[model samples]
Target: MKMNIKSLYAICTAALLAGCTDLDVNIESQYTQYPINDIAVEAKNADVYFHLRDVFGRRYMEAMSLSSDEYTAVSYGGGWYDSGCYSHPSLHDFRTEDASIDWMPTVISGITKANTVIRDLGGEEAAPADIAPARAMRAFFTFIIMDCWGDVPILDYLPVTNDEVVRAPRAEVARWIESELLEIIPQLTDEVSDNTYGKPTKWMAEALLAKLYINWAVYTASSVEQYEAATAENEKLNDCIRICDDIIASGKFNLGSMPYAEKFGPDNGSQVEDFIYAMPYDTYTATGMQYGRARTWKNAGDVEKSYYGMKLSNSAGGYITMNPEFSRLFCLEGDIRNNSVIGDTVHVYDPNTYQPTSEIALDENGKPIVLTQTVSLEIPDDVQLGVGDNTKGYSQGYRSVKFFVIDDDYKNGRNQSNDLPIFRYADILLTKAEAIVRGGTATNGETAMSLFNQIREYAQAPLLATTPSLQDLLDERGREFFDENWRRNDMIRFGTFENEYGFHKKDFPTARFEKTCRIFPLHRDVLNTYPHWTQNPGY
Candidate 1:
């Protein structure tokens, strides 16, 4: 069951605390009365938790890149493709129709439910591991709000009356997220189920908390005690570093030297590198999105097509493509990272036979060549250049091959495996590097440089002998974690929230990429539901 945002909200708000009600009432009065004791098994309803997870996942996939790329003016939620397609677009308008899914309510709902579970399942009556899971789940959801939409009304549980639903500011929300994670960190169990590999571990909490602190500038506006805040946040990052180090030190997980494709392949879902948090998609027929059934040809599967015989694209092809600038950043010769993440030089689509199952062909020596097997969309043929350089046939140019699946099983389209890498070890290392850079330190400090160089070495990309500048760390982050949703926050931390990119710099008529556009507006309908809640500044 897909856990919709509304369901999370309903579950969180509906949480009935252990002592809040009396049990001696008449049985006939209630048609479906789940005694508080009955709620103990509710944690097993991973279905509900999974839905909430999906809700958070959707927000990350869609809304996480407000500060990184260019701004193209496509239809639904125009900001992403417009701002995202290029190296750096001047404006990433948040108020447009194409903004990320309204993630506020869904996250709030999850946090509420998790807290309620923690509150109610604590007595001697609670199950062996229920409380830990509840706390972990709560921490997971709260981190999303703290990281994405700043300043939310942090409700510990569902409000008894409508008046209690008023929202809180970003700082207060961050504190609340921190408090919840700290409260539950010690309570969670070390051992987790195999199916729950991506589920929150104790280390995951620390990492997420560290991430929240890493973006302290955007969260706190760097107006007060910026150094202290950065320091404090970095401390949390260090704590996270320690946590990952400890996990690594133990025999539980290890870095796999497997090729990048094999590392992310479905068979390795249970592998140690993948042992970090990831969403597992199974092959069960009715089992909720098993096998990457992408909705477009860009995604390797039997999704739909465009009416004009062009490949039907989703959301202006949130299709992950490499930015030309990012591509240039990489060393073309002998960089294994290039081969691991980047792929087939070109991805050309045939309009005449653009059927769901029609095999994509390539042009070799000016002759169309067809491969024996089904092909995944890797680097696309589209290459949109600057104003002066030829602009013909380059509208949909320069695609990313990082998330494109090329394993053999996806011949006809879509596979039942391939867990999406939400948070990975590479991210952990990158975050540590960024935190060290932004944590009230010098531009060329050893602490930050060491972390940054490790990533460079891992990628087999050249590393700098001298320490890196602060901007260097941020730029490196862009290259290391592109399209993974860390760009907006990293840009904001580096003080580039308002820069322009792609065609948006000269194209957008009304919007300018300003710092004021950081947080999303409280959805208009949500404001109608709760009038007392104040919208974020400048939204």
Candidate 2:
């Protein structure tokens, strides 16, 4: 179905109205204008494409990062702090509301859009090329909700009434995600062409399956079944290995020879290592590539604005700095990943020349214009915060420059053009290595040690002579995928999320670390609307 601006507006208006009613009626009305017979194929495809973009925005990424031990909330001093830094109950105990609540509706809306595409395109009879990406997207969105909230309502088909809005078991949702990916892999395109660049492809389906299988126990296990859960978890780990083997053998992608920073550069859309999918962003057409703002230091803003012309709003609160432990994951000696961190020094530019200068610039009070403090892996007790403050010092934390910043001509007001990678070829190698160490077989041409060294080679770090333990693998993932939004999930899977890391003790001295913190509470407003909904355990 081809959608014009008028039809798009109509569908959006209907979705808003239906959102007030039953989930079924909501989805049904959202697709009323673009019925199967009336809509063009191009319109249906465009709808799915737009929703995929909407689903992969910065808010989702920042929320996941803040919830993990990947960052330490640096204070701006005088009691000023980023609300997002300390506002979530999961991140800091003093906050009353859950941050994940704000995300629920947006994610649910994405799923609804995916469903509309599948339904209007003829359901089971829809063309494989057209429906496969939509199915994969729906599965991906579902997996995220389940990963964050445990049990969520699964609206597979359009509903007739609101009575169907009941939470599905997490394990059941996991199984459905597994089944959906397995069923659609063959139908997805194997090649990476212009049409498939940001869309879900065959490799993405396999990657999603590998992720699901590897974290199966965390996703499905119950408190009552400890021993049984471990056994099932190991089996799922093996399944993860098999799926990863298929992805590695597909010959569609390989670990690129480019430096780590270059892989995330503005032109990264052309990088080969980006195996599964990327959320394509452009300054003009597709925007919201704001990871740079969330991670960049406030003092550096003037330099960025002056030199690069990139506007640094710092509006998402303040800079997201590495939790002392996460920063130490990088080998400062030769690891390229370590180069992403900015500390101590600020670049000085000549005002007239607008070029980088050797002399450090000074403020009116005679202090350095960009005051950078030595960032310690151990956060100071005095800066521990349960609320925002104005006194947080500027230089107390190390900033991440992982994402690419375009040339100085790039305007601050424009969104970045760097493509956000969802999955990479290096991740596949690490997944295989970890699976092997966990007792899964390696059938994809490389031993676990060899695969491990492949990444180390690119990182310019020393190779391992012996096989790595699970802890070593976890450390490697932290070093490699840091700031990419996988840390929280990795910490949970490794059983480290409940530990007192970073400044958690200072901020919430008496709080207990519990398993219920694994899945966040459903937003309070969502519960108020649907009285039948039950909150997660510890909310």
Largest TM-score belongs to which candidate? 2
1-539, model 2: which lDDT tens digit per residue?
11132245334334431222124444544544544432354455554455545345565675677667777555454333545434343344423254424567766767776776777677777777778877888898888888888888786765555455778888899999998888999988888655466667888888888888878877777631231322545667678888888888877787777767777755566444554677766655565676765565554444434222344433333446666666667654787777666445544433333234565544223455442333332243344443233223545555666674554313545366667777787888898888787778777577888999988888888888989777888899888887777888887777777666556553454344666767676676677767788777765
Candidate no. 1 TM-score:
0.70
lDDT of 2: 0.64
Candidate 1 clash figure, as a count: 28
What does the lDDT read for residue 345 in candidate 1? 33
lDDT of 2 at 163: 56
- The 10-residue segment with the lowest total lDDT in model 1: 370-379
lDDT of 1: 0.46
Model 1 C-alpha lDDT per residue in residues 315-413, reported as the tens digit of each score: 122233333444554553444545323223333332222112233323312332221111111222112222211111122334343343332323322
RMSD of each: 9.0, 5.5
Error of 1 at 513 (Å): 1.7
Looking at model 2, report the run of 10 residues with the lowest lDDT sum: 13-22
lDDT of each: 0.46, 0.64
